[model samples]
Target: MNIFVAGMMMETNSFSAIPCTRDSFVNAMYYRPEHTGPDPEPAAYEQFGYRTFLRLARERGYGAYASLHAFAEPAAPCRQEDYESLRDEILDDLRAAMPVDMVFLMLHGAQMAQGYDDCEGDIIEKVREITGPDIFIGVELDLHGNVTTRMAEASNALVACLLYPHTDFDERGEQLFAIGERFARGEIRTRNHLQRVPMLGLYYTTLPHMMAVNDAVLAAERQDGIHSVSLMHGFAWADHPDVGAAVIVVAESGQGGVPDLARDIGRQFFAARDETRSLRRPVDDILGAIAASPEAGPFVIADVADNAGGGAGADSTFILTRLIERGIKDAALAMIWDPIAVDFAWQAGIGNRLNLRLGGKTGPFAGLPVDGEATVVALADAIEQEDPAGGLMFGIGRAALLRIGGILVAVNSIRQQVYDPVCLTGLGVDLSALRIVVVKSTQHFYERFSTLATGIFYCETPGSLTLDFDAGRYSRLRRPIWPIDADAAPA
Candidate 1:
């Protein structure tokens, strides 16, 4: 069967000041063959979902045609022109390649365009109009996907990664394709049932270390006729009307079975909602733990509030500022995404001592740029490396190592989430000798660093996607949710 695969993904943070444009996508990650070369395909960390989907579909003996796949680091809502042009380009390609048996999409479910709040839903609806209702459509989404009713009604079948800090992209892609293959053979008539929890939150609830949501996911996986079960923690940054956590169950038939399974899972999710809300430690508590630890091994401190994966500007220097204040030496922060700083460092060359202002360039929430004298340690144009902690592959764009005061910072031109040590060691930064390693990511960093770290702490700070949702100046989110009201009854 002929299958068409294409994707456009970008998580929107409504609160962010950064406007996502075509140039932003290009600067962050532009993989056009004409621009790069014939052999070296445009590759970036954000395209992980799309690449895996195409790879799995080709392996399943289907004639897979990947038209185009484009993604950028999480940022503010996309511009109207940029969104329409990209959407039309993908749809235009799909129309030309019509008569395909199936279409698989990789989407960041929380995307908000200038004129469109439900862009993914709109794309799916438009694609449905082109392919018609009978044509099978499948989607692979991040666990942070906002599984809106509009999205649920438009797509034929959908699957989301179960793990937070998501290491299950490939696994979920395989599952989605398997379901598509089953549909092609007429083996299973798939139906999906989705239920949204009242509260809106981040990745704290989805952690395996946290029992409530984790056990519920495990239980749903055991249910019969349930091909796949996903718990979308939902993207908390997008201030759309459909912002909240959700449970989706894909069953064998498009009937009562899926709904029943979904309800079972939804109830459990609601029952445990309290336990899942806002799990984090204060900055002081995290620092105390680090000071108490005796192991010489590097400890990982997660700056969740400034996680780029959650649409926060990776340039936030709150954690870095505090590190410098504490006089913490022998530590590394793999990365602070600033093209200007990287360019300045590049011009300075390796071993050159220079004064530079790093990070805090995004906005006030990101704090002010730290001005200090730093020594250039190492420099590299491209680093093809795997996450030392999780084994996930990532491409680090033009990067440089600079030692500022007591801390070592790896500055990259590209904005990305640093999940593993390879992002550092790949560029000649030693991971074994450092006392602490600060990662500007949420839970995805856990998969790789949890075992290696003597201590892992999530630092509460200030940024667009801060874990302190209650403290955020939100204008749109539906209220009475947990933590927002301690006395309010659970969903």
Candidate 2:
């Protein structure tokens, strides 16, 4: 069997001011077909999820051909020329390597280039144009993927990871390959159906699996003829027309229950929409909760609005400023994206004190950059942590740990969500020794930080990815979407 691998991942936030240029991917992550091998190091896997498919093909002795592997940090819609150049590279490769038995595409569903709103759908349609209808095309989508009719109509099958922090990356990779193998061997006829639900909001679907939508997906998958069920949470930060939760049910092609199952799940989501949202509180209110809590030591408060994962600048000082004002001590926060501060700290060297301004550089929402006398306690060229799911290493660039008035703040050069403890522990901050820990993330931090915190609180601060969905401004999105329109339902 011959298998082709290719991927393009970028979670876009239309509200963000950052432009995702070609340099974003080039500087962050970009690889040619020849650059990748069958087995990849953990750090590479964390950066790019494409290695799993390549490894699978190699292990099975199948003809595996890799295309461009590119990933950019979450930001505003990609540049038109930049996205087109990369898209053409992947398509051009597929065109050159014709007559392939199968194709596996790893896509982040919420990509929106300058001129293209449905980037994933556009790529899949182009691939279909090259491969025709005979070849088996399978896709692995992020749960946050904004599933579209174009994508659902073009691909043979689509599988999305069930976890939020994506612990099931390998499992989903194997599942997509399994679907392709079965199709190639004539084991079972499969059909993927997508049912878009008219709902838009931010929510946490972390472990302990409290979300009802997750439970419903599992229940639907257990039913006869259901091969897999995915609740594409839909990236709420992307202001596309199809930006809403979707139910994708895969089952036997001839099975009559697929559509019904899909519709039922969609309805379930609409009925339980309130439960799907995270409980958020104002910064001061959340801080009060932390002070009153009788729980034993360190508590974690998520600065959700400033989560870099959803394209908000991680440098927002809404939470950090308040912590400083409250005179909170023994509290640590990793990473405030302030390269200026980091550079100053680096110049001061370790154990040296310097007065500097940190974070609050973006806008009014970011608050004023805090000014204080800080001591550089720790410095790292880069910080990386192994993902417990498969040892995938997630990391960011140059960082410095600084202590200011008993508060430890991690200053980073790059922007990324704090998904793992290594971001702090690597910078020499003793997480256990602190009374409070603040992470600039919405939900991704749940998997790692929850394990260490005595209690977790979600802060409803102000920034680009703010959870006040109804208050968001959108110029292109069509109206009548849920929450925005009280009587809205899927069209």
TM-score of each: 0.88, 0.93
Q: Write the per-residue lDDT of candidate 2 for residues 85-166, one digit (tens) a residue.
A: 9999998888777778899998989999998999999999999999998788888988888899999889988899887677
Question: Which model scores highest in TM-score?
Answer: 2
lDDT of 1: 0.74
The regions of model 2 sitting more than 4 angstroms off are: 35-47, 207-212, 276-278, 387-391, 470-472, 489-491
Error of 2 at 420 (Å): 1.9
Q: lDDT by residue for model 1 over 1-491, one digit each (tens)?
A: 87777777788888887778987666654443222111124352234446665565545555555655677778888998998888887788778778888888888788888999888998888888899877778988877788787787788787887766566677778778888878867887776778766666664534543456667666766776777788877777777668777888777774445666666666666666545344567777787778887888688888877877766778988888888888889999987988888888899999999899999988888998999898888888877555432243567788988998888898888777777777788778778888899888877777677878877777778766665675356666666555565653433
